[model samples]
Target: MRTQSHLRIGDQPWVKWSLITLALTLVFLLLLVPLIAIFVQAFSGGVSSYWQNLTDRYTLHAIGLTLFVAALTVPINLVFGVFLAWLVTRFEFPGRKLLITLIDIPFAVSPVVAGLLYLLLYGANGWIGSRLMDQDVQLMFAWPGILMVTVFVTCPFVARELIPLMQQQGREEEEAGVTLGASGWQLFRRVTLPNIQWALLYGVVLTNARAVGEFGAVSVVSGNIRGETNTLPLHVELLYQDYNTVGAFTSASLLAGIALLTLFVKSFVEWRQARQRAALSEDEA
Candidate 1:
Protein backbone atom coordinates (compact mmCIF):
# COMPACT_ATOMS: atom_id res chain seq x y z
CA MET A 1 0.00 0.00 0.00
CA ARG A 2 2.83 2.38 0.85
CA THR A 3 4.61 1.55 -2.44
CA GLN A 4 1.37 1.96 -4.38
CA SER A 5 0.68 5.34 -2.79
CA HIS A 6 4.24 6.48 -3.56
CA LEU A 7 3.87 5.36 -7.20
CA ARG A 8 0.58 7.24 -7.57
CA ILE A 9 2.11 10.45 -6.21
CA GLY A 10 5.13 10.10 -8.53
CA ASP A 11 2.87 9.48 -11.53
CA GLN A 12 0.85 12.63 -10.76
CA PRO A 13 3.84 15.00 -11.04
CA TRP A 14 5.06 13.27 -14.19
CA VAL A 15 1.68 13.71 -15.86
CA LYS A 16 1.36 17.30 -14.65
CA TRP A 17 4.83 18.31 -15.82
CA SER A 18 4.35 16.52 -19.14
CA LEU A 19 1.15 18.45 -19.84
CA ILE A 20 2.72 21.74 -18.81
CA THR A 21 5.73 21.17 -21.03
CA LEU A 22 3.56 20.21 -24.00
CA ALA A 23 1.42 23.33 -23.58
CA LEU A 24 4.45 25.62 -23.35
CA THR A 25 6.06 24.04 -26.39
CA LEU A 26 2.90 24.52 -28.44
CA VAL A 27 2.56 28.14 -27.32
CA PHE A 28 6.15 28.91 -28.20
CA LEU A 29 5.96 27.25 -31.61
CA LEU A 30 2.54 28.54 -32.62
CA LEU A 31 2.49 31.99 -31.07
CA LEU A 32 5.80 33.25 -29.74
CA VAL A 33 7.91 32.06 -32.67
CA PRO A 34 5.66 33.64 -35.28
CA LEU A 35 5.55 36.88 -33.32
CA ILE A 36 9.31 37.02 -32.95
CA ALA A 37 9.80 36.18 -36.63
CA ILE A 38 7.54 39.06 -37.68
CA PHE A 39 9.54 41.66 -35.76
CA VAL A 40 12.83 40.19 -36.91
CA GLN A 41 11.80 40.34 -40.55
CA ALA A 42 10.34 43.79 -40.18
CA PHE A 43 13.65 45.08 -38.82
CA SER A 44 15.90 43.06 -41.10
CA GLY A 45 16.54 45.99 -43.41
CA GLY A 46 17.42 48.28 -40.47
CA VAL A 47 15.34 50.85 -38.49
CA SER A 48 15.26 53.38 -41.32
CA SER A 49 13.83 50.88 -43.74
CA TYR A 50 11.29 49.72 -41.19
CA TRP A 51 10.20 53.31 -40.50
CA GLN A 52 9.98 54.11 -44.20
CA ASN A 53 7.97 51.01 -44.92
CA LEU A 54 5.40 51.92 -42.29
CA THR A 55 5.34 55.62 -43.23
CA ASP A 56 4.93 55.04 -46.95
CA ARG A 57 1.94 56.91 -48.29
CA TYR A 58 -0.01 53.74 -49.03
CA THR A 59 0.93 51.98 -45.80
CA LEU A 60 0.03 54.99 -43.65
CA HIS A 61 -3.31 55.34 -45.41
CA ALA A 62 -3.99 51.62 -44.99
CA ILE A 63 -3.27 51.90 -41.26
CA GLY A 64 -5.51 54.94 -40.98
CA LEU A 65 -8.36 53.27 -42.85
CA THR A 66 -8.03 50.15 -40.69
CA LEU A 67 -8.29 52.29 -37.56
CA PHE A 68 -11.22 54.22 -38.99
CA VAL A 69 -13.14 51.07 -39.82
CA ALA A 70 -12.49 49.60 -36.37
CA ALA A 71 -13.60 52.85 -34.70
CA LEU A 72 -16.92 52.84 -36.53
CA THR A 73 -17.45 49.09 -36.30
CA VAL A 74 -16.73 48.70 -32.56
CA PRO A 75 -19.13 51.43 -31.38
CA ILE A 76 -22.00 50.41 -33.65
CA ASN A 77 -21.67 46.78 -32.62
CA LEU A 78 -21.36 47.77 -28.96
CA VAL A 79 -24.69 49.61 -29.06
CA PHE A 80 -26.40 46.86 -31.00
CA GLY A 81 -24.87 44.17 -28.80
CA VAL A 82 -26.09 45.82 -25.61
CA PHE A 83 -29.61 46.36 -26.91
CA LEU A 84 -29.83 42.83 -28.27
CA ALA A 85 -28.56 41.31 -25.03
CA TRP A 86 -31.02 43.37 -23.02
CA LEU A 87 -33.94 42.48 -25.23
CA VAL A 88 -33.21 38.80 -25.38
CA THR A 89 -32.38 38.34 -21.71
CA ARG A 90 -34.67 40.85 -20.01
CA PHE A 91 -37.90 40.11 -21.83
CA GLU A 92 -39.80 37.15 -23.16
CA PHE A 93 -40.75 37.55 -26.76
CA PRO A 94 -41.81 35.56 -29.77
CA GLY A 95 -39.00 34.60 -32.14
CA ARG A 96 -36.37 35.34 -29.50
CA LYS A 97 -34.52 32.15 -30.30
CA LEU A 98 -34.76 32.81 -33.99
CA LEU A 99 -33.41 36.29 -33.46
CA ILE A 100 -30.42 34.87 -31.60
CA THR A 101 -29.75 32.32 -34.32
CA LEU A 102 -29.90 35.02 -36.96
CA ILE A 103 -27.43 37.09 -34.96
CA ASP A 104 -25.05 34.13 -35.10
CA ILE A 105 -25.43 33.63 -38.85
CA PRO A 106 -22.34 35.70 -39.51
CA PHE A 107 -20.29 33.33 -37.43
CA ALA A 108 -21.61 30.37 -39.38
CA VAL A 109 -20.95 31.97 -42.76
CA SER A 110 -17.47 32.21 -44.14
CA PRO A 111 -15.99 35.71 -44.32
CA VAL A 112 -15.57 35.23 -48.05
CA VAL A 113 -19.21 34.24 -48.31
CA ALA A 114 -20.16 37.28 -46.27
CA GLY A 115 -18.36 39.51 -48.77
CA LEU A 116 -20.03 37.77 -51.67
CA LEU A 117 -23.44 38.13 -50.05
CA TYR A 118 -22.95 41.86 -49.67
CA LEU A 119 -21.79 42.14 -53.24
CA LEU A 120 -24.87 40.39 -54.49
CA LEU A 121 -27.07 42.58 -52.34
CA TYR A 122 -25.32 45.86 -53.05
CA GLY A 123 -23.36 45.41 -56.21
CA ALA A 124 -24.03 47.83 -59.06
CA ASN A 125 -26.46 45.44 -60.70
CA GLY A 126 -27.67 44.01 -57.39
CA TRP A 127 -31.25 44.33 -56.11
CA ILE A 128 -31.03 47.61 -54.14
CA GLY A 129 -27.75 48.54 -55.82
CA SER A 130 -29.48 49.52 -59.04
CA ARG A 131 -31.81 51.89 -57.22
CA LEU A 132 -29.01 53.38 -55.14
CA MET A 133 -26.85 53.79 -58.24
CA ASP A 134 -29.50 56.08 -59.72
CA GLN A 135 -28.63 58.43 -56.88
CA ASP A 136 -24.89 57.83 -57.66
CA VAL A 137 -24.33 55.86 -54.48
CA GLN A 138 -21.38 53.50 -54.49
CA LEU A 139 -21.56 50.78 -51.85
CA MET A 140 -19.81 47.65 -53.08
CA PHE A 141 -16.31 48.97 -53.68
CA ALA A 142 -16.12 51.70 -51.07
CA TRP A 143 -15.45 52.50 -47.43
CA PRO A 144 -19.15 52.15 -46.63
CA GLY A 145 -19.04 48.57 -47.85
CA ILE A 146 -15.97 47.83 -45.73
CA LEU A 147 -17.65 49.29 -42.66
CA MET A 148 -20.80 47.26 -43.32
CA VAL A 149 -18.90 44.00 -43.61
CA THR A 150 -16.89 44.68 -40.46
CA VAL A 151 -20.07 45.37 -38.52
CA PHE A 152 -21.67 42.25 -39.91
CA VAL A 153 -18.75 40.08 -38.91
CA THR A 154 -18.35 41.55 -35.41
CA CYS A 155 -21.97 42.24 -34.37
CA PRO A 156 -22.38 39.06 -32.34
CA PHE A 157 -19.32 39.35 -30.11
CA VAL A 158 -20.64 41.58 -27.37
CA ALA A 159 -24.12 40.09 -27.44
CA ARG A 160 -22.70 36.60 -27.04
CA GLU A 161 -20.58 37.76 -24.13
CA LEU A 162 -23.44 39.45 -22.31
CA ILE A 163 -26.44 37.19 -22.93
CA PRO A 164 -25.29 34.27 -20.78
CA LEU A 165 -24.13 36.63 -18.06
CA MET A 166 -27.38 38.61 -18.03
CA GLN A 167 -29.44 35.44 -18.06
CA GLN A 168 -27.54 34.02 -15.12
CA GLN A 169 -28.02 37.32 -13.25
CA GLY A 170 -31.79 37.16 -13.90
CA ARG A 171 -34.12 40.15 -13.84
CA GLU A 172 -34.72 40.23 -10.11
CA GLU A 173 -32.51 43.24 -9.45
CA GLU A 174 -33.99 45.00 -12.42
CA GLU A 175 -37.46 44.30 -11.10
CA ALA A 176 -36.51 45.70 -7.72
CA GLY A 177 -35.16 48.86 -9.33
CA VAL A 178 -38.31 49.24 -11.36
CA THR A 179 -40.46 48.81 -8.26
CA LEU A 180 -38.46 51.63 -6.67
CA GLY A 181 -39.66 53.90 -9.47
CA ALA A 182 -36.48 53.85 -11.48
CA SER A 183 -36.98 54.68 -15.12
CA GLY A 184 -36.02 52.09 -17.71
CA TRP A 185 -32.87 53.94 -18.70
CA GLN A 186 -32.10 54.72 -15.09
CA LEU A 187 -32.42 51.09 -14.06
CA PHE A 188 -30.13 50.03 -16.86
CA ARG A 189 -27.58 52.69 -16.10
CA ARG A 190 -27.62 52.28 -12.33
CA VAL A 191 -27.95 48.52 -12.10
CA THR A 192 -27.65 46.52 -15.30
CA LEU A 193 -24.76 48.40 -16.86
CA PRO A 194 -22.65 48.20 -13.73
CA ASN A 195 -23.07 44.46 -13.52
CA ILE A 196 -22.21 43.82 -17.14
CA GLN A 197 -19.60 46.52 -17.79
CA TRP A 198 -16.61 44.19 -17.52
CA ALA A 199 -18.12 41.64 -19.84
CA LEU A 200 -19.11 44.40 -22.23
CA LEU A 201 -15.57 45.70 -22.25
CA TYR A 202 -14.27 42.23 -22.93
CA GLY A 203 -16.65 41.88 -25.84
CA VAL A 204 -15.66 45.26 -27.21
CA VAL A 205 -12.02 44.26 -27.05
CA LEU A 206 -12.75 41.13 -29.02
CA THR A 207 -14.86 43.02 -31.53
CA ASN A 208 -12.15 45.59 -32.01
CA ALA A 209 -9.54 42.89 -32.60
CA ARG A 210 -11.67 41.14 -35.19
CA ALA A 211 -12.58 44.42 -36.89
CA VAL A 212 -8.95 45.46 -37.25
CA GLY A 213 -7.69 42.05 -38.25
CA GLU A 214 -10.47 41.30 -40.68
CA PHE A 215 -9.10 40.55 -44.12
CA GLY A 216 -11.22 38.32 -46.31
CA ALA A 217 -14.55 40.18 -46.17
CA VAL A 218 -12.90 43.56 -46.32
CA SER A 219 -10.67 42.37 -49.15
CA VAL A 220 -13.62 41.50 -51.37
CA VAL A 221 -15.40 44.83 -50.88
CA SER A 222 -12.38 47.14 -50.75
CA GLY A 223 -11.36 46.60 -54.38
CA ASN A 224 -7.81 46.83 -52.98
CA ILE A 225 -7.46 50.48 -53.95
CA ARG A 226 -4.12 51.43 -52.48
CA GLY A 227 -4.06 54.54 -50.23
CA GLU A 228 -7.84 54.59 -50.29
CA THR A 229 -9.65 51.35 -49.54
CA ASN A 230 -6.82 48.99 -48.68
CA THR A 231 -6.72 47.98 -44.99
CA LEU A 232 -3.57 46.85 -43.22
CA PRO A 233 -4.11 43.20 -44.02
CA LEU A 234 -4.79 43.91 -47.65
CA HIS A 235 -1.78 46.20 -47.72
CA VAL A 236 0.40 43.40 -46.43
CA GLU A 237 -0.72 41.23 -49.30
CA LEU A 238 -0.15 44.06 -51.74
CA LEU A 239 3.40 44.54 -50.50
CA TYR A 240 4.15 40.86 -50.81
CA GLN A 241 2.78 40.80 -54.33
CA ASP A 242 4.93 43.77 -55.19
CA TYR A 243 7.98 41.76 -53.95
CA ASN A 244 8.56 44.11 -51.01
CA THR A 245 9.13 41.35 -48.50
CA VAL A 246 10.43 43.56 -45.71
CA GLY A 247 7.60 46.03 -46.25
CA ALA A 248 5.07 43.26 -46.13
CA PHE A 249 6.46 41.94 -42.87
CA THR A 250 6.60 45.47 -41.45
CA SER A 251 2.93 46.00 -42.16
CA ALA A 252 2.20 42.59 -40.71
CA SER A 253 4.14 43.46 -37.57
CA LEU A 254 1.85 46.39 -36.87
CA LEU A 255 -1.12 44.07 -37.02
CA ALA A 256 0.61 41.54 -34.78
CA GLY A 257 1.30 44.35 -32.30
CA ILE A 258 -2.38 45.23 -32.21
CA ALA A 259 -3.23 41.57 -31.64
CA LEU A 260 -0.73 41.33 -28.77
CA LEU A 261 -2.22 44.41 -27.18
CA THR A 262 -5.71 42.93 -27.47
CA LEU A 263 -4.49 39.70 -25.89
CA PHE A 264 -3.01 41.66 -22.98
CA VAL A 265 -6.29 43.50 -22.45
CA LYS A 266 -8.21 40.24 -22.64
CA SER A 267 -5.95 38.70 -20.02
CA PHE A 268 -6.50 41.69 -17.75
CA VAL A 269 -10.27 41.44 -18.16
CA GLU A 270 -10.21 37.72 -17.38
CA TRP A 271 -8.14 38.34 -14.27
CA ARG A 272 -10.57 40.99 -13.07
CA GLN A 273 -13.53 38.73 -13.78
CA ALA A 274 -11.92 35.91 -11.77
CA ARG A 275 -11.43 38.27 -8.85
CA GLN A 276 -15.04 39.45 -9.06
CA ARG A 277 -16.30 35.86 -9.05
CA ALA A 278 -14.14 35.03 -6.05
CA ALA A 279 -15.47 38.02 -4.18
CA LEU A 280 -19.05 37.11 -4.99
CA SER A 281 -18.49 33.50 -3.86
CA GLU A 282 -16.99 34.70 -0.57
CA ASP A 283 -19.96 36.99 0.04
CA GLU A 284 -22.38 34.14 -0.61
CA ALA A 285 -20.45 31.88 1.73
Candidate 2:
Protein backbone atom coordinates (compact mmCIF):
# COMPACT_ATOMS: atom_id res chain seq x y z
CA MET A 1 0.00 0.00 0.00
CA ARG A 2 3.03 2.28 0.42
CA THR A 3 3.97 4.67 -2.36
CA GLN A 4 6.82 3.54 -4.58
CA SER A 5 10.23 4.59 -3.27
CA HIS A 6 11.96 7.27 -5.31
CA LEU A 7 15.04 7.80 -3.19
CA ARG A 8 18.48 6.80 -4.36
CA ILE A 9 21.95 6.84 -2.91
CA GLY A 10 23.51 10.31 -2.98
CA ASP A 11 20.20 11.77 -4.08
CA GLN A 12 20.02 14.14 -1.16
CA PRO A 13 20.79 17.73 -2.18
CA TRP A 14 23.54 18.29 0.38
CA VAL A 15 25.16 14.90 -0.23
CA LYS A 16 25.21 15.46 -3.99
CA TRP A 17 26.75 18.90 -3.66
CA SER A 18 29.30 17.70 -1.12
CA LEU A 19 30.42 14.83 -3.32
CA ILE A 20 30.74 17.12 -6.33
CA THR A 21 32.77 19.60 -4.31
CA LEU A 22 35.08 16.88 -2.99
CA ALA A 23 35.75 15.46 -6.46
CA LEU A 24 36.51 18.91 -7.88
CA THR A 25 38.83 19.70 -5.02
CA LEU A 26 40.69 16.40 -5.41
CA VAL A 27 41.11 16.92 -9.15
CA PHE A 28 42.46 20.44 -8.64
CA LEU A 29 44.91 19.39 -5.93
CA LEU A 30 46.16 16.22 -7.65
CA LEU A 31 46.09 17.06 -11.35
CA LEU A 32 45.60 20.70 -12.28
CA VAL A 33 47.82 22.14 -9.56
CA PRO A 34 50.80 19.98 -10.53
CA LEU A 35 50.39 20.77 -14.24
CA ILE A 36 50.23 24.49 -13.48
CA ALA A 37 53.27 24.24 -11.22
CA ILE A 38 55.29 22.58 -13.98
CA PHE A 39 54.62 25.41 -16.41
CA VAL A 40 55.27 28.03 -13.79
CA GLN A 41 58.62 26.57 -12.82
CA ALA A 42 59.52 26.03 -16.46
CA PHE A 43 59.13 29.69 -17.40
CA SER A 44 60.31 31.09 -14.10
CA GLY A 45 63.54 32.15 -15.79
CA GLY A 46 61.65 33.82 -18.68
CA VAL A 47 60.77 32.64 -22.18
CA SER A 48 64.29 33.00 -23.54
CA SER A 49 65.67 30.85 -20.76
CA TYR A 50 63.00 28.21 -21.31
CA TRP A 51 63.74 28.16 -25.04
CA GLN A 52 67.45 27.86 -24.43
CA ASN A 53 66.99 24.96 -22.04
CA LEU A 54 64.76 23.18 -24.51
CA THR A 55 67.19 23.81 -27.36
CA ASP A 56 70.21 22.47 -25.51
CA ARG A 57 71.98 19.69 -27.42
CA TYR A 58 71.21 17.07 -24.82
CA THR A 59 67.58 18.07 -24.63
CA LEU A 60 67.24 17.93 -28.38
CA HIS A 61 68.89 14.55 -28.46
CA ALA A 62 66.60 13.28 -25.75
CA ILE A 63 63.58 14.47 -27.68
CA GLY A 64 64.80 12.85 -30.88
CA LEU A 65 65.59 9.57 -29.16
CA THR A 66 62.26 9.44 -27.38
CA LEU A 67 60.47 10.02 -30.65
CA PHE A 68 62.60 7.41 -32.37
CA VAL A 69 61.78 4.79 -29.77
CA ALA A 70 58.07 5.54 -30.01
CA ALA A 71 58.16 5.48 -33.78
CA LEU A 72 59.54 1.97 -33.88
CA THR A 73 57.52 0.68 -30.93
CA VAL A 74 54.16 1.74 -32.34
CA PRO A 75 54.31 -0.06 -35.69
CA ILE A 76 55.79 -3.24 -34.28
CA ASN A 77 53.16 -3.47 -31.59
CA LEU A 78 50.36 -2.50 -33.97
CA VAL A 79 51.04 -5.39 -36.36
CA PHE A 80 51.62 -7.87 -33.55
CA GLY A 81 48.51 -6.75 -31.71
CA VAL A 82 46.29 -7.05 -34.76
CA PHE A 83 47.59 -10.47 -35.63
CA LEU A 84 47.29 -11.74 -32.06
CA ALA A 85 43.79 -10.37 -31.67
CA TRP A 86 42.73 -11.86 -35.00
CA LEU A 87 44.21 -15.22 -34.16
CA VAL A 88 42.65 -15.62 -30.75
CA THR A 89 39.25 -14.20 -31.60
CA ARG A 90 38.84 -15.68 -35.08
CA PHE A 91 40.25 -19.12 -34.48
CA GLU A 92 39.61 -21.78 -31.84
CA PHE A 93 43.10 -22.93 -31.13
CA PRO A 94 44.76 -24.72 -28.22
CA GLY A 95 46.40 -22.55 -25.58
CA ARG A 96 44.57 -19.44 -26.83
CA LYS A 97 43.53 -18.38 -23.33
CA LEU A 98 47.02 -19.01 -22.02
CA LEU A 99 48.43 -16.88 -24.79
CA ILE A 100 46.03 -14.09 -23.87
CA THR A 101 47.05 -14.40 -20.24
CA LEU A 102 50.71 -14.24 -21.16
CA ILE A 103 50.09 -11.01 -23.00
CA ASP A 104 49.27 -9.36 -19.66
CA ILE A 105 52.64 -10.26 -18.16
CA PRO A 106 54.03 -6.82 -18.83
CA PHE A 107 51.16 -5.27 -16.94
CA ALA A 108 51.60 -7.55 -13.96
CA VAL A 109 55.39 -7.45 -13.79
CA SER A 110 57.29 -4.38 -12.60
CA PRO A 111 59.04 -2.36 -15.30
CA VAL A 112 62.28 -2.32 -13.34
CA VAL A 113 62.11 -6.10 -13.11
CA ALA A 114 61.51 -6.38 -16.83
CA GLY A 115 64.51 -4.19 -17.54
CA LEU A 116 66.70 -6.13 -15.18
CA LEU A 117 65.64 -9.39 -16.80
CA TYR A 118 66.47 -8.00 -20.22
CA LEU A 119 69.80 -6.79 -18.92
CA LEU A 120 70.59 -10.21 -17.50
CA LEU A 121 69.68 -12.04 -20.68
CA TYR A 122 71.10 -9.53 -23.14
CA GLY A 123 73.87 -7.87 -21.18
CA ALA A 124 77.50 -8.77 -21.79
CA ASN A 125 77.76 -11.43 -19.10
CA GLY A 126 74.64 -13.61 -19.32
CA TRP A 127 74.54 -16.70 -21.53
CA ILE A 128 72.99 -15.05 -24.55
CA GLY A 129 74.85 -11.83 -23.86
CA SER A 130 78.21 -13.64 -23.68
CA ARG A 131 77.51 -15.28 -27.01
CA LEU A 132 76.47 -11.96 -28.51
CA MET A 133 79.61 -10.37 -27.06
CA ASP A 134 81.68 -13.13 -28.65
CA GLN A 135 80.16 -11.86 -31.89
CA ASP A 136 80.94 -8.24 -30.89
CA VAL A 137 77.33 -7.34 -30.16
CA GLN A 138 76.08 -5.21 -27.28
CA LEU A 139 72.53 -4.37 -26.22
CA MET A 140 72.44 -3.29 -22.61
CA PHE A 141 73.34 0.27 -21.53
CA ALA A 142 72.54 1.61 -25.02
CA TRP A 143 69.74 2.80 -27.26
CA PRO A 144 69.01 -0.76 -28.39
CA GLY A 145 68.43 -1.75 -24.79
CA ILE A 146 66.20 1.28 -24.34
CA LEU A 147 64.19 0.28 -27.39
CA MET A 148 63.87 -3.29 -26.17
CA VAL A 149 62.57 -2.35 -22.71
CA THR A 150 60.22 0.24 -24.10
CA VAL A 151 58.79 -2.30 -26.51
CA PHE A 152 58.33 -4.84 -23.75
CA VAL A 153 56.53 -2.37 -21.52
CA THR A 154 54.14 -1.11 -24.22
CA CYS A 155 53.40 -4.23 -26.24
CA PRO A 156 50.17 -5.14 -24.48
CA PHE A 157 48.27 -1.88 -24.97
CA VAL A 158 47.12 -2.33 -28.55
CA ALA A 159 46.27 -5.98 -28.11
CA ARG A 160 44.37 -5.33 -24.88
CA GLU A 161 42.35 -2.63 -26.57
CA LEU A 162 41.53 -4.68 -29.66
CA ILE A 163 40.71 -8.02 -28.06
CA PRO A 164 37.48 -6.98 -26.38
CA LEU A 165 36.28 -4.97 -29.35
CA MET A 166 37.03 -7.76 -31.80
CA GLN A 167 35.42 -10.30 -29.50
CA GLN A 168 32.19 -8.29 -29.39
CA GLN A 169 32.31 -7.94 -33.15
CA GLY A 170 31.74 -11.57 -34.09
CA ARG A 171 33.11 -13.09 -37.29
CA GLU A 172 29.76 -13.37 -39.03
CA GLU A 173 30.43 -10.59 -41.50
CA GLU A 174 33.90 -11.97 -42.18
CA GLU A 175 32.52 -15.43 -42.80
CA ALA A 176 29.86 -13.99 -45.07
CA GLY A 177 32.53 -12.15 -47.00
CA VAL A 178 34.47 -15.39 -47.36
CA THR A 179 31.37 -17.14 -48.64
CA LEU A 180 31.05 -14.40 -51.22
CA GLY A 181 34.51 -15.30 -52.53
CA ALA A 182 36.33 -12.51 -50.74
CA SER A 183 39.99 -13.07 -50.23
CA GLY A 184 41.50 -12.98 -46.72
CA TRP A 185 43.12 -9.61 -47.29
CA GLN A 186 39.96 -8.32 -48.87
CA LEU A 187 37.78 -9.33 -45.93
CA PHE A 188 40.17 -7.81 -43.40
CA ARG A 189 40.75 -4.61 -45.35
CA ARG A 190 37.10 -4.14 -46.25
CA VAL A 191 35.27 -5.42 -43.16
CA THR A 192 37.51 -6.00 -40.16
CA LEU A 193 39.59 -2.84 -40.45
CA PRO A 194 36.61 -0.52 -40.80
CA ASN A 195 34.85 -2.08 -37.84
CA ILE A 196 37.82 -1.67 -35.48
CA GLN A 197 39.44 1.50 -36.81
CA TRP A 198 38.49 3.63 -33.81
CA ALA A 199 39.70 1.06 -31.29
CA LEU A 200 42.89 0.62 -33.26
CA LEU A 201 43.55 4.33 -33.33
CA TYR A 202 42.83 4.61 -29.62
CA GLY A 203 45.28 1.80 -28.89
CA VAL A 204 47.92 3.44 -31.05
CA VAL A 205 47.54 6.69 -29.16
CA LEU A 206 47.98 4.88 -25.82
CA THR A 207 51.02 2.97 -27.12
CA ASN A 208 52.67 6.19 -28.30
CA ALA A 209 52.00 7.86 -24.96
CA ARG A 210 53.52 5.03 -22.93
CA ALA A 211 56.44 4.68 -25.32
CA VAL A 212 57.26 8.35 -24.96
CA GLY A 213 56.80 8.58 -21.20
CA GLU A 214 58.41 5.34 -20.07
CA PHE A 215 61.12 6.02 -17.51
CA GLY A 216 61.75 3.15 -15.11
CA ALA A 217 62.65 0.40 -17.58
CA VAL A 218 64.41 2.77 -19.94
CA SER A 219 66.44 4.17 -17.05
CA VAL A 220 67.61 0.73 -15.95
CA VAL A 221 68.87 0.01 -19.46
CA SER A 222 69.78 3.40 -21.01
CA GLY A 223 72.94 4.13 -18.94
CA ASN A 224 71.94 7.85 -19.04
CA ILE A 225 74.85 9.00 -21.20
CA ARG A 226 73.46 12.54 -21.59
CA GLY A 227 73.18 13.28 -25.32
CA GLU A 228 74.01 9.70 -26.28
CA THR A 229 71.26 7.62 -24.65
CA ASN A 230 69.33 9.89 -22.31
CA THR A 231 65.60 10.31 -22.94
CA LEU A 232 63.49 13.29 -21.87
CA PRO A 233 62.43 11.73 -18.54
CA LEU A 234 65.99 10.75 -17.75
CA HIS A 235 67.14 14.18 -18.85
CA VAL A 236 64.66 15.78 -16.48
CA GLU A 237 65.89 13.63 -13.58
CA LEU A 238 69.50 14.43 -14.40
CA LEU A 239 68.80 18.15 -14.52
CA TYR A 240 67.00 18.09 -11.19
CA GLN A 241 69.81 16.11 -9.58
CA ASP A 242 72.34 18.61 -10.94
CA TYR A 243 70.25 21.42 -9.37
CA ASN A 244 69.10 22.85 -12.68
CA THR A 245 65.51 23.36 -11.57
CA VAL A 246 64.45 25.48 -14.49
CA GLY A 247 66.01 23.13 -17.00
CA ALA A 248 64.35 20.16 -15.37
CA PHE A 249 60.97 21.79 -15.58
CA THR A 250 61.59 22.83 -19.15
CA SER A 251 62.18 19.22 -20.14
CA ALA A 252 59.17 18.20 -18.10
CA SER A 253 56.96 20.67 -19.95
CA LEU A 254 57.59 18.89 -23.23
CA LEU A 255 56.43 15.61 -21.67
CA ALA A 256 53.37 17.37 -20.26
CA GLY A 257 52.54 18.68 -23.72
CA ILE A 258 52.78 15.19 -25.15
CA ALA A 259 50.49 13.84 -22.45
CA LEU A 260 47.93 16.58 -23.10
CA LEU A 261 47.98 15.89 -26.82
CA THR A 262 47.51 12.18 -26.20
CA LEU A 263 44.56 12.87 -23.94
CA PHE A 264 42.91 15.01 -26.59
CA VAL A 265 43.31 12.35 -29.24
CA LYS A 266 42.01 9.63 -26.92
CA SER A 267 38.91 11.68 -26.11
CA PHE A 268 38.26 12.38 -29.77
CA VAL A 269 38.58 8.72 -30.64
CA GLU A 270 36.14 7.81 -27.88
CA TRP A 271 33.62 10.39 -29.09
CA ARG A 272 33.83 9.06 -32.62
CA GLN A 273 33.35 5.52 -31.35
CA ALA A 274 30.27 6.52 -29.37
CA ARG A 275 28.77 8.34 -32.34
CA GLN A 276 29.43 5.34 -34.52
CA ARG A 277 27.58 3.15 -32.04
CA ALA A 278 24.64 5.55 -32.10
CA ALA A 279 24.50 5.52 -35.88
CA LEU A 280 24.68 1.74 -35.89
CA SER A 281 21.86 1.48 -33.39
CA GLU A 282 19.68 3.72 -35.53
CA ASP A 283 20.35 1.61 -38.61
CA GLU A 284 19.41 -1.57 -36.77
CA ALA A 285 16.17 -0.04 -35.55
lDDT, each prediction = 0.93, 0.93
RMSD of each: 2.0, 1.8
Model 2 compared with the native: what TM-score?
0.96
- lDDT per residue for candidate 2 within 84-175, as digits (tens), equals 89999999989999999999999999999999999889988887998999998878888889999999999999999899988977899999
Best-fitting candidate, measured by TM-score?
2
The lDDT of model 1 is 0.93
lDDT of 2 at 198: 94
